[model samples]
Target: MSERKPVVLVTAADLAPEALALLGGYEIVYAGKTPSDDDIVSLCGQHDPAAIIVRYGKVGAAAMAAAPSLRVISKHGSGTDTIDKTAAAARGIAVRAAAGANAAAVAEHALALMLACAKSVPLLDARMRAGHWDKAVHKSLELHGRTVGLVGLGAIGLRFARMADAMGMNVLGFDPYAKELPSFVQRADLDTLWKQADVISLHCPLTEENRNLLDAKTLARCKRGVIVVNTARGGLIDEAALLEAVRGGQVRAAGLDSFAVEPMLAGHPFQKESGFILSPHIGGVTSDAYVNMGLAAARNVRGVIEAR
Candidate 1:
């Protein structure tokens, strides 16, 4: 009799064909889009997967406990915040991430957000659609020679720094754990960065220590009219505080790709604010990045399973 193939569960509706090919030997099971925690746990209990490739929804300790055979949890993208790392460690399950798989795509999105905020692209487009020509009264903020401050100089942050540097912007970065930075990037403390940066961008993972890093108090310290961009996690910012800052003109504009809540609730205050530009966390959703992340995740899964 033939033996059962080892099960590998993916926490999304689909993965790239190439990635699936790489794991041909394993039996793949997918949890549909918008999977709830309960769904993940149920799937784990049913599949008893040897590995899990997370693409959406949170993987809590409960799910980890459901699959005693689970050997690894590999993130489809860079951030592993969605996975409960502590619980995995306790159960002897390895946690890994496909780091830098979406770096280029996310960095480009950050740059687009910066430009959109600085030049009021969405606002201008709306005005044009309304048959109003404000070219005579409007002035766009030129990015050249401006200073851009970056938080979390990891892969995405470093890529953004390079783009900003190329545009003649002075790049100041704050990442305590970063080492061997490029000559174009000047390392600075948070206080200095807040005071001097004309533009601020976030590219760090979310952690308990840094939740609400850009709250009312911190936002108040930044240069008035500073443009803010976040392509990272949404919990890093205080949403209500950001809305108030925009309303009060303390922050000229904010470009946010991630929100504190997924698919932000209807009639959120930011929805009414003209100074805010938002995307549905699609910074890393490009076709190229999708394939890259999926492939990396599959390879990571294979590496762990084969080694054992």
Candidate 2:
């Protein structure tokens, strides 16, 4: 008789059939809705699965503590902010993410936001739909001669820089960890970049040091009427400060995909702010990207279970 394959628990949303097929022989346990820490603990205790896969939801310490048999944690996406990595590391659980799986999608979304802001696409479309043709008030700016500053030159940032360069925009980047800038991009310190850039885009992760990195003081350094794009984490920019800047005309336009608070509140100032475009954290949410990440997570789970 064949031995039973190790069990695996998936605590994310509905799985695509392709993602499911990657599990092959494993005994799969699906937690359809968002699971609380206590629920996760109970599930792990009952299943004693070889691994647990999670998406945007939090997996707390209690859940990690209860899963004694867990050998790996496969994150469905790149961000591991919701997971307690320290606890998992202490327990000798291998944590893996599909880091580059959605890079291109996110980069393309960032460029789209930048172009929309530069061309005043949202405002023009709204006016046209309202039967008021206000072309003069919504005059678009040319991106060809503008300077773009990238705050973090990671995989997504570099990809965005390439797109911006191809659009005839000059690219400058700032990242303390980066050793060298690509030939097309100029390297600048944060303050210099703020002063010189007509458009500024953020592409950094959320960490204690970078939380609220774009506060009032730093924002004050930016060139007046600067366009801002944030496809990265929301906490990096101060929401209240951004609102103030927009109201005061310090910021000409803003494009944001993520927010300090997920599913931004109904009456948020940005919703009413003119020339601002907001997406519901869809920067890396292309169908192809989703399948790529899901398959990567499934394969990670299989690897852990089959290790000799």
TM-scores, all models, native as reference: 0.99, 0.92
Q: Model 2 misses residue 79 by how many Å?
A: 1.6
Which prediction has the highest lDDT against the true structure?
A: 1
- Regions more than 4 Å wrong, model 2: 1-4, 36-39
Backbone clashes in model 1: 0
Shift in Å, residue 100, candidate 2 = 0.9
lDDT of 2 by residue, 52-156 (tens): 888655776777788788889898877777688889888988888877778899999999998898888888888889999885665788989799999988889
Clashing pairs in 1: none
lDDT of each: 0.96, 0.86
Q: Write the per-residue lDDT of candidate 1 for residues 1-308, one digit (tens) a residue.
A: 99999999999999999999999999999999889889999999999999999998989899999999999999999999999999999999999999999999999999999999999999999999999999899999999999999999999999999999999999999998999999999999999999999999999999999999999999999999999999999999999899899999999999999999997899888888899999999999999999999999999999999994
Give candidate 2's error at residue 202 in angstroms.
1.5
Report the Cα lDDT for residue 68, model 1: 92
Q: lDDT of model 1 at residue 158?
A: 98
